[model samples]
Target: MAEKKYKKIVLAYSGGLDTSVLIPWLKETYGCEVIAVSGDVGQGTELDGLEEKALKTGASKLYIEDLKKEFVEEYIIPTVKAGAAYENYLLGTSFARPLIAKRIVEIAKKEGADAICHGCTGKGNDQVRFELAIKAFAPQMDVIAPWRFWELNSREKEIAYAEAHNIPLKITKETNYSKDKNLWHLSHEGLDLEDPANEAPVNKPGFLELGVSPEQAPDQPAYVTIHFEKGVPTSVNGEAMDCETVIQTLNKLGGENGCGLLDVVENRLVGMKSRGVYETPGGTILYKAHEKLEEITLDKETQHYKQQLALKFAELVYNGQWYTPLRKAMSAFVDSTQETVTGDVKLKLYKGNIIPASVTSPYSLYSSEMATFDEDDCYEQGDSAGFISLFGLPIKVRAMNDEALAEKTGTHFPSVE
Candidate 1:
């Protein structure tokens, strides 16, 4: 069958090695006018000079949309409120992919492009993430994945192609590690990090981008107080700031202390186990503080049940199911649990550790009077006797039946008194 020709293709441009080469490749291979769209999700300095570069690489134009504010409010807050962490990962790149893809579709529709393209490889989770999002909004739009199709299989080949085409490369052959960075976190994969046995070269240059290593962290502990309003962070250290500002503040504090380094071999949705190192400095502080706040505010049953919901929520986000109905339903359930999640949590950051100094909440369910051993009117000691007896009634009945049967049969049945 003949392939449908694409007249105009919208490419998710990152200005990185793959996408840098993609602008020319898409044009040369498909004979299509390439429109590059880069979503600005707080990837500092990565966006710089993207316009000139895109134009230089055969793209008709570039769209550097500022999606940072929307990214935090729309994606980051709900995930944090839901307490979703995929296998100890903070779901940074997971949730951001959908938002960026959605924006690309919007631009595609506006530009009247025949198709959309991404630089994600066939083996990674981002391919599913980008395409699933595109399918949700613009299912009919033709999608192009150059890495899965192009002859340039490795970074070495892509670098050679760029040089042949007079296209500049940001990274050299010696230090080419696939990385994804946003406001929420910075992730490092490939190189020696691909092997689970090898430890992350945190002390080495280019290994740690966002923060200091634990050994290089400061000797003195830094204290921070974060205020929350209905599961949303409102302030840091008594100063009221916007959510973006709040995150930036915590990122600075947490980065300095080496608080959020995660080195793990996680299950990728592509049916493979991949190793990566993530630095989610500010996000780590917020997640810890938010979870601690819920400890005081949420009831025992609600908290326990919410924890189960959180695990599923993380799975949905990690598996690129963010735009689906199940995720919406789970988010709704998470929001209901967060009504009373209003509080302030003080934490002590000491060299990769987040120690809770104190936690306070207006809606806290913790009762000092009931929990006190000295004297308490809220809880009756006599009631515990009745509660224990009732709770043990089923066990007592089973034991008596066993004992009766044993005696009649001349069999010894030992029971704890």
Candidate 2:
């Protein structure tokens, strides 16, 4: 083909098989110096020896940036406030892509590179997410997607290429499931998961590292309280901590309790359905607690309206529109609604269930005097007759018309009994 335009490329490297292969392929194809950049979003042991791995795989230099605090405070918290769960998913993988892309763009600029590269496959949603994020942050930079360009199609071919080139990779042919892990979640896909008919074992060993199996969970229930200030989580139980600490603590606690493990067959943005098993223990607990706090703090109208905005917000995040004006506007609305969302939520975690026990907000709209069935000075029982009549007017009208028609036709309408 034609010669590549760029002389230096910054790759969003994960030290995975695809990315490791891409480093060599990019150098061979374009003869460009590859600078690998990996964002440390609390991937834990995955980040170990990544610099040595990247440099050995033909990278000229490696930059591993720590972005855990920023990721949770900036991206994850905003999503939680907006209640952005894409088709019931907590947008675990979806939210991390933009932050990863942003870091890649930053490294490209710093290294004076003209192009950015990634290992996202052509058929996957991540390609769109990564590319769109690049377009948003640095529209002028050339994006090199190796999976879209390279002739090597399957994982087998890529692994064979890696073997031929003597590229040291952690993944082997026997266990080839593609995974992405961070502070928010761990996602598993590919290999045997491609088949819908395949039954996922209830207790698959080695497959689940983040959470306890339901059968292995503690018999006694565990309880914890989460404190939020303006919709952002501030503490666990009664301890005040920073953003990163809160996530780390919750992740450990929720994992031990088996609080969050989801297996879903979801439709991708690329018009294909894929199955993934996700472990999002911390995120699951946070969402449940946050929602419970909102139930007491927000008024009926505002709460319902925010729920509608949540669907749109989730779509934007899932579709990689994080830097868009619409997302910012929606965030403003979400923030405004969250002003009174400061509260404490007590929860009961038993096995895999996160049950909300009690919630108390400083701005709570709930009033015992107004809501109680007992005799109260704030409410008069006699007033319910007029209110109920007006509330059921449409239903009463339809029913009366149907009754009149039935009487005129000398036929009895269907009765509830």
Name the weakest run of 10 consecutive residues (lDDT summed) in model 2. 196-205
Q: Residue-wise lDDT of candidate 2 within 232-294, one digit each (tens)?
A: 999998999887788778888898888888888988998989898888888999889999999
C-alpha RMSD between model 1 and the true structure: 1.9
TM-score, model 2 to reference:
0.94
Error of 2 at 409 (Å): 10
Question: What TM-score would every model get versus the actual structure?
Answer: 0.97, 0.94
Evaluated against the true structure, the overall lDDT of model 2 is 0.88
Best by TM-score: 1
RMSD of each: 1.9, 2.4
Pairs that clash in candidate 2: none
Candidate 1 lDDT over 147-253, as tens digits, reads: 78779989899999999999987788878998999988999998888888888999997578788998999999999999999999999999999899988889889
TM-score of structure candidate 1:
0.97
Q: lDDT of all the models against the reference?
A: 0.92, 0.88
Candidate 2's C-alpha runs over 4 A off are 1-5, 395-417
